[model samples]
Target: MELWFTEEHTKDVRFTIRVDEQIESVQSDFQKIDVFQTPEFGKVLVIDGYIMLTEKDEFVYHEMITHVPMSVNPNIKKILVIGAGDGGTVRELTRYNTVERIDMVEIDKMVVDVCVDHIPQTACKLSHEKVNLYFEDGLKFVKTKENEYDLIIVDSTDPVGPGMELFTVDFYENCFKALKEDGILVNQHESPYYAREAAAMQRAHEKIKKVFPVAKVYQAHIPTYGSGHWLFGFASKKYDPINHMDEEAWNKLLIKTKYYNSALHKGAFALPNYVLEMLEQNI
Candidate 1:
């Protein structure tokens, strides 16, 4: 027997999920993480009631999330990842030869331990020599460091539980201070159709706009996340997402991708009228 999850992303598209018996399940005092065997997405990790990652669709999120900034800033060396307990972001970040070190700050040690032990499909990157792991709050760890990183990627879980604080204005300011003048920050901004989630994204974007000279919202479509369409918040000081893409670098470094390409890179930034309206009206 199998199960499925589906929703219409747009008038032209519908996202679907089909799953078999669970491959793995972990319940902590704070949350429950489940990995299920899925036909379309291979193995999917669900934390609490939210879809965290799917082996099949993971590349779309991880690659787009990691590559967009790196493609813009070529010299990024010291990378900081917040709340990516499973190491998928680190895995993608390592693909960049310029990334010499990765400091992954995660709030839950249990999540790290569980992923390292059971979710190798997504957690395999932690074993790499370049990654330095820390079990601390993403907000607090970022405060002590100032102008130290070239890139910071926040692979935070959906805003809930310990992940709640990572979405605040204070956290964005701390990240700005912790980043080098040229450093860039990118984080999951969640879905657009769900009003509550959309407002959260807008609020976060507004805060980032206040502190960072360059703050933009880009989106991707993932089957597991609500409404399939998802958005990411980008904040930077010296790099412009619109002006910074190096065609030679992106095309050369291109990996096998089911979604996300140089074309989508440009297309993704072409926000629909409503998004533009939000970006403008709110500012």
Candidate 2:
């Protein structure tokens, strides 16, 4: 018999992948964690039956989330990452030599430990000298800080379970307060292709727009994520992702990326008409 893993994207829809081997399975304080190996996606990390990342296409997500804001503001020295327990977000952020300090607050330390042992590709840089890992609630962590970080990335899961508070308006306000005067915030905005995900996406955008001077949504295609069309939220105090993007300066840095590029940076913000309509409905 063959073992396969399935994640229900909706009541009637499911995604199934063949599992080559089960590496580890544990019940953490927050969620169920599983690591598996597959022929196609390489190593896979699943949390609460949801596919978090795979070695094959993880670059698309980690790069898009980190590079977009970094390219927009090359001077981002201090960064706070919320809920990225897998450490892929931190790995990408570590590539920027200009970044001086990284404060990563992950609610579940088991996710980090499992990823470090089974998925080293994404978790390799979690121990970088500049990184300070905190196994605490990100919501309460942000509430205690003010005008400290130049960039804040909320690399959280779906707005459910431990991630629920991270999407609330109060959390967005706390993130806004935690940022410096010219700070930028990039977060995992839910997808717009499905009804449930679209509703969450709209609510997040509406709330962030109310708190930040500039708020925009950009997208990337991650095959494992629901509907293969994932969106990221970009909210800033002053800089605009497109207008402030220094293509020449970014290119001069000679950073090699698989998904994010200067051209894609501008094109990503071109939301589809239907997505635009959805956002407009909330406005």
Q: Candidates' lDDT values, in order?
A: 0.80, 0.94
Residue range 46-80, candidate 2, lDDT tens digits = 99989999999999999999999999999999999
Candidate 1, residues 1-283: lDDT per residue as tens digits? 5577544444565566777767677787678877667777777777775678877778788878888887787788999999888778888887777789999998778778877776787788797889999988789999999989998898887677988898888998899999998889998887767766777677777788998998888988876777777898778987888688776777787566567677788788877888777666673
Q: TM-scores of the models, in the given order?
A: 0.90, 0.99
> TM-score of the candidate numbered 2?
0.99
Which 10-residue span in candidate 2 carries the lowest summed lDDT?
274-283
**Lowest-lDDT window of 10 residues in candidate 1?**
5-14
lDDT at position 279, candidate 2: 82
Off by over 4 Å in 1: 1-18, 254-256
Instruction: For residue 247, give model 1's deviation from the true position in Å.
Output: 1.8
Q: For candidate 2, give the lDDT.
A: 0.94
RMSD of candidates 1 onward, in order: 3.2, 0.8
